[model samples]
Target: MAGSTKTKAKKPTVKKPSANKAAEASHNGAAHAFAPEPGDFRRYFDSGHTHESLGITPETLLDMYRNMLLQRRFEERAAQMYGRQKIAGFLHLYIGQEAVSVGSVWGTRPDDPIITAYRDHGLALARGMSPNAGMAELYGKIDGCSRGKGGSMHFFDVDKSFYGGHGIVGGQIPVGVGMAFAMKYKETGGCCLTYFGDGAINQGAFHEAANLASLYKLPVLLIVENNEYAMGTAVHRASAEPDLYKQAYAYDMKGAIVDGMDLFEVYHAMQELADEAREGKPALVEVRTYRYRGHSMSDPQKYRTKEELEAKKDEDPILRVKKYLLDNELATIEKLDDLDESVKAEVMAAVEFAENSPVPEIETMYEDIYTQSDYPFLV
Candidate 1:
């Protein structure tokens, strides 16, 4: 790590939200649109001032904007490395969905548990994991949080309480519920944020896990990141009802639709839900977000058109946050530019560390596949 000098799972019983109840509840909310009401969401596009009008402090807005920019830059760097062939395997970049992760993660305490799908680089960074450590994982270096075996999809750090970067589509759902159950059973003041994509909504696991969480009133937040596409397949083409938040009715829990592109809106929604979960109630949040990149690094995007992509770019979450900061004079252009440069340097440092760090020793591969290890496991 001389080049940079930078810092830094599990399958459980699977459950699905009950179909009969979900179906019944889904119909009840059908009469209402999932879009947030007038005051439910705060828009930054046309606003000259933020935080004050939104009842949040200038410090909070700056903090949220900084976090979102970090995520945006982190993913951008990951994509660049993937292009250079420095990173291998599947790479799911969270380019346009920064607000969802940054905002939601900010709402949780240091001791709270957070779990999500394979797109976890941003989540890790938001939870205080360094860019150097995350990039090192992508490069398969021993210094990675997982000792380099997990790559981009499995960056687990028990000390920080990030459960994992689960590779399976909906696999983390039940695990999130179980973590919540453990917290309740052991009387720990912790909750789990289980995140997955809209594509995974149809998975039987979601229905089952959701039902259990609600029935038990476990301290968990079921976050469905409705980014409109599941691996290049649009939701309209796949889902019967694209309003993902409506599924919450089946579990008899609270549900809300948040503007995933706006950090303020996402923060407000996540804060409220986290409170509900802590009070021994389960809830669901459908973050209506969009991913600027393909489902993964290799996607050619034949499924959609450039015009549509450009249109969505107009709603860039990072830009919205930045504009809000400037308009309110919370941060000046010089400060933001300095911040951008700092992040870029941080990312470059991480890449250098990953390129220079040692790969895991060959002999170590014989260890850690099971509860008990044998030397020949590598062979």
Candidate 2:
């Protein structure tokens, strides 16, 4: 009995995924996408390139850099606010993945429907949501975008066509498809940008949504913000197809992967996908990004090493744009420093606004509830 033998089953090998117009076959099993593995993402977006080359004006580039700074400073302040217990419930920071949202948004129109996962504050800010309203929402005050009802994970702005800050993993995937369907039906040339983390790729919802979007030729861009980790689990360990965008092949949808650390790469990739999506071609894009903080406030983050984080910091999206601006001579050091100071002041004011804003009134709860015929107290 001790000498009895059993054979192990062979595992299928999947070559890593690549980016751009169409998927390409690899020679010698190499990936077309150069990102987290390369350690030198800046080489592709070399110091020689200018904002004009990227089709953005000098002032617009400055604005993009400023927005990135706003996101970083906002998230930093939000962390402090959470620590003080001024903000309650869960708080997920978007410190390191600003480019994925900002760059993707830059490639699309303001009217395009934007929906994303619970890590939403940065996207909201990038899309022009005021810091005061955003911080107020975190503080659960009446001035919040959701009237303080949605909290951190449910920042919604109908005016901006930003549908939600969805809480459930993979829940927003189907909803995004539906939004795209509506866009197509209305004959609106807008492409719906559906954002989710790497964690949501395997969900049945994503697969089902992708099938429908591809089958009907919906105008939807399924953007997977592959931040290396889905909560605590690394992408490779959790996913059978670790190169997440390749999952699009199942539905015959086009897919591309980008160096999420580089804003130019993200923007250019997203711009191409958006053009296709608006023409009724469903697509998937994996913005390979990273989050510096733990998955959420409660996470201890014992999974990763401090050295790994320090190395990632070298590719910081905010610094990338700042470098481009300075190196291109579009902005001076004093100008950039002043921009930082102004952004700092703006964040501080948002904190003050949240502190002073009043909590939501009880009657409003009865008002938003769909089942209500009349307010219970009023009745």
Candidate 3:
């Protein structure tokens, strides 16, 4: 007893209650349940109205028509080239979704940065990127905007501020945010128009970018070009909350849904949203548009029926704009026909230019690979 100290009795350890169970218990007896109100999502403008009321002149309408027609014709030719094996790699045609890009681009300033997913020829053309350059990029020619390196999905025009045709789903989200952040940091009086699809809205990148954009009040317009499908998967099947614009509510930002099939509606909505974005208010816009073709040239398109595709054709943006032009007496049928002929000719010339252009040299593969010069080891 004198040599050895008596051991103290060990106390039994007690496990603490689970925090999740405690939280549930605290709410168990509450009379009210937590329920969030539905977001106030509505079309901000009427699609049926004439552009005159919105201060869009006849000339501007004609330009919009021409740009949309140019994009359509260019894509048609590109599809033909793909079929002929003249153009290689993935060809994501922007057949029916032309209005979203054309109208949205027209709504923003010329210097404002614009970015979109791989279905991007329309956006590049709408932003005034030359068809020759775009087609050359598809042909992997030296005259391409990316020096014949980017192919169909990576069209980038630094001079026009067209950021890129990002190939990865939701890959452009944070890049767009970074561009907006730069604009804010530089006080450039410019904003960014970032476009993705309904499929991308489910990506974590979009949510993180949306949260950051809201937190920093970044000048960016996050557009969800909801064509109802992400590749073969339908939006309804993929998203638990199919209403994409409402997702912005979680970030405490403004959101709206528009008839992306109507050029006038898209133009007006984009105009207002672009103005808001330039004023440092980031917003989410869901453009309910549809694509006429398969996800890519290789797709068999077993997901939807021919009947569904035919039904959506009735709301074709190009045809709708053409009808509006005729109905409003903005342009006669003859003039429109002439304009269509001109666009076709232009597209054909672009194809010829691409055919004649030289392919990028093998050495070019090493160029434009890295931006940092300090990494001399790369050489």
Across residues 94-150, which tens digit of lDDT does each residue of candidate 3 receive? 899999988898887999999989988999999999999999999999998898999
What does the lDDT read for residue 55 in candidate 3? 88
Best by TM-score: 3
TM-score of 2: 0.86
What is each predicted model's overall lDDT from 0 to 1? 0.82, 0.87, 0.90
lDDT of 2 at 81: 89
Model 1 C-alpha lDDT per residue in residues 1-379, reported as the tens digit of each score: 5687644445677898555755766885644444544543222222232466557787777777777777787788888888889889988988999988888887677778989999888788888787778889999998888889999999887788887899999999998999999998988867788999998888999999999998887999999999989997889898988777777776666777888888777777777778778888777889899999888888899999999999999999999888878876789999999988887888889889999989999987976676533556643
| Tens-digit lDDT track of model 2 for 181-224 | 98899898989999999999999999999999999999999999
Cα lDDT for residue 82, model 1?
A: 86
* Clashes within 3 Å, all models in order: 7, 0, 0
Q: Which regions of candidate 3 are displaced past 4 Å?
A: 1-42, 45-47, 375-379
Report model 3's TM-score to 2 decimal places: 0.88
Off by over 4 Å in 1: 1-50, 53-56, 372-379
By lDDT rank, best first, the candidates go: 3, 2, 1
In order of appearance, the predictions have TM-scores of 0.84, 0.86, 0.88
Whole-model lDDT for model 2 versus the true structure? Answer: 0.87
Q: Which of the numbered candidates is closest to the native, going by highest lDDT? A: 3
By summed lDDT, the worst window of 10 consecutive residues in model 1 runs over: 40-49
